[model samples]
Target: MRHAVTLLCLLVLAACARVPGPFEHDPSRDYYARPRTDKAEVAISPPRNMPPQMGQRVAATLAMELQSYGIVATVAPADAPIQVDGVMSTRDADLSIEVQVDWRVVGRPRTDEPATVKTRARPEDYAEQSERLISRMAQQAAPRVATLVGKPPNFIPRAPGQVAAGITIPYEFPSDPAADGTAAAAAAAAATGTTPTTAPVPTKPAEQQIKVLVAPVTGAPSDGNRQLYSGMRRALGSSKIVIVDGAGEDVFTVVGAVNLTPIDDRTGKLVVKWVLKDPAGKIVGDIEQSNPVPLAAARGSWAGFGDIVASAASEGVLELLEKAINRPR
Candidate 1:
């Protein structure tokens, strides 16, 4: 099965590279013809502007795949934690067909990213080849959608900290209602004439501190970018993020790019892009941020620009780190 899936992915890529021009969309085919399992419901939103038949087929294909994994999938289920929607458009690039999909969690607009797939095939076979690639891409994305929706309610991701120092999260599990139900029930019965007692909720701890490496900032002039490194260190350090000089086992690396434009003699706009990566070099996520600057304060030296941009970067990183720590695994 794994080999078949791998081959399907490779074939889809190869076919997309050859297909050219507008692909035909057939609306009569049934993509979900296999037996399905009964499970938790997932809503699949019909992709907007796509050919009706092709869109429905893709949605059905996703729903069928999800059902196999113990998730009940439907077209627009009334209540679901997440829904899948996609938009397909073709462009002339190396005479190949490209399909892009963007999936997100319901009510969480920030988790949007594109998943693209391609196929290489003759122009005469573009329609069949395109559908094949779309179906394959839908299949590939189903597992990820299911996993995201299946995350535990109390899931807490590992704190974003230094690779060398690692993170330490101090937490106490809340009392389980099932375990204390009998006692609580008896207490409630006895206290019917009075107020019933309740368990105290556990308090969450402060952010975990770890070693962080703030790489020298880039994308600005050398003369004005001088104090960026130190400024970033100070800004992030004040937010419970300790800066380190070198990489280590638990060290987190912060890389930044800034674009500063002079709006006027007294005003400037700074756009800072930040990327956070672990010691092993896997990207945690972007911590990029932007803020307008007062040229009067940020004009005299590169340090002035560093002060404003680094502070914004610091705030952005803190926000993303907190979200990562609290996000479901």
Candidate 2:
């Protein structure tokens, strides 16, 4: 009798922990999660509970798998051919659902199987199974996705971090080197016509007036880093990258601590550290931006600590811009 009671209690707990099953999301109503493609022109919001990578790994694997099946497809934020959206859930089975994939160019409706698959397992076993099944199903649907894209199915399995890797944090006041004192001097000379001094101009235009989010985790935001945040915001905004109303929309949420500890000077990069968080305050990206700051770096040199910080931060910031630009719409 005691044994029977224990079994009942266990079953009750198991039932209480049930997750949603397949077909749970209503794509007809847009009540679904989306794909994670670094190539997406805009980042769709992630579901409330899952990590960013969870969606990315699954999306990439799914896209690759769908491609194998000859479906005409592309990842979401795709203004391309067909946009394949995904919905994931688990219960008696682990299910990664396409919910519904929309086509920018309509295709022949299916008289055949709907896009779905399910693998039954314990709660702990669901995540892996769901990923694999989603991948397999996506592979099965590639032909359709390809067709929707009006191409011979060219689907690239984007590696994880490709999106995040593109996010960068800059550390320069005059992100546009053209805005430096030399440029100022040139402008002054051009205005005053005082023996017009000649200063070589940099050909590459810097991103300006692009309002960026600075989530610093370093010991302190170096002067260069602060300048970068200020300058890049200005440059990107003025660079015609966004509409006036859309200015400051591009944001990178930093997370983690930027370790500034250098084992040695000169050989040691300035101690820099930080990470990024999503708008919901979830951390998705991290990095340490520091290069060897020579002891002599104190003596103003061309490659001083300030210069190095700006360079490192600029690299990080540029990456962020790339990610922002590429995120799915």
Candidate 3:
């Protein structure tokens, strides 16, 4: 079975070498369409165990980060259903600070677990980088908070016959010329009133494995491109799908692009698009994620932010690959 699968993959690679082109939408296909959930509104309470000014800064940054995920967030005191409270502590020796936040939806059962975020700053730059540190902490906490309060992202459902016992590739192979020739020879013998030669029959059909190549993310801020790329690779690796480092052995390729458009002076809309293509360079489909983000939160290094975005988008990318593999021959 292993040797048969290997031979099948080699045959696929040798059959096509076309590069992919720009995205073209197919209105007829609804593979990427999923029902959107209603947006949630959240209010951030003042931080405890910190100076009033610093606490307010933390609250404000947290609000901004939540807003980026399409949640209506505010630091001002409000009558929102979801309330978030943060308790903070700083260690002077290491110049590190940790913030533990509890998210509660009014009238709902609350758990003891609080989402914790921590960041460290250089001693020499501590005073000057206070805002940066706060931003980092907020970025880390936003995803957790959003998950608790905001509506969850759409999940792609697995197609029929997809849940096999092991790693089964869903690809369909091309017609075998030898099989066709055998049938033709049998027909000729029958017409001539002669006995036909026996042909060997396989007990099971050969299986072909599919490999995907993930390209570097483009148009992201700071080191976001590399960060997103690494995050995507990690996400794909955790799944049943096989990921290839080089394009030479891949059956499909994935490319990501980021676009940031300013909504106002303080906030911007961040759009991340993941495009999947076959070996022939035809666009299989695309997954897009967009939200309003504070300019301050996205202006600097996207250290942790990239991973968060990539993790969320990988689900849809895998779905696209599945569709391609299971597509009719």
Instruction: Provide TM-scores for the models.
Output: 0.32, 0.25, 0.39
User: Which has the higher lDDT value, candidate number 1 or candidate number 2?
Assistant: 1
For each of the candidates, give the backbone clash count.
21, 71, 2
Q: Scored by Cα lDDT, where does model 2 land?
A: 0.35
Instruction: Please identify model 2 stretches exceeding 4 Å from their true place.
Output: 1-211, 215-258, 262-267, 296-308, 315-318, 321-329
Candidate 3 lDDT tens digits, 11-87: 23223342111111223222235232233368887667766876777677667555434466788587666777766
Candidate 1 lDDT over residue span 1-329, tens digit each: 00000112212322452322111112221125433323336788766666676677667656644542345677774465456565556555444444445555566566454333232333433465343333344445554565556632121111121111111112123455555775676687787866555655444464465667778667754333434654565566545565555688878788877686887764556565778776788777775454455433333334233444466557667766666556686
Off by over 4 Å in 1: 1-207, 260-270, 290-300
lDDT of 3 at 98: 29
TM-score: which is higher, 2 or 3?
3
TM-score winner between candidates 1 and 2: 1
User: Looking at model 2, how many pairs of residues clash?
Assistant: 71
RMSD in Å for model 2: 25.6
Tens digits of lDDT, candidate 2, 247-296? 13344444323233444643233444444444445444444543333222
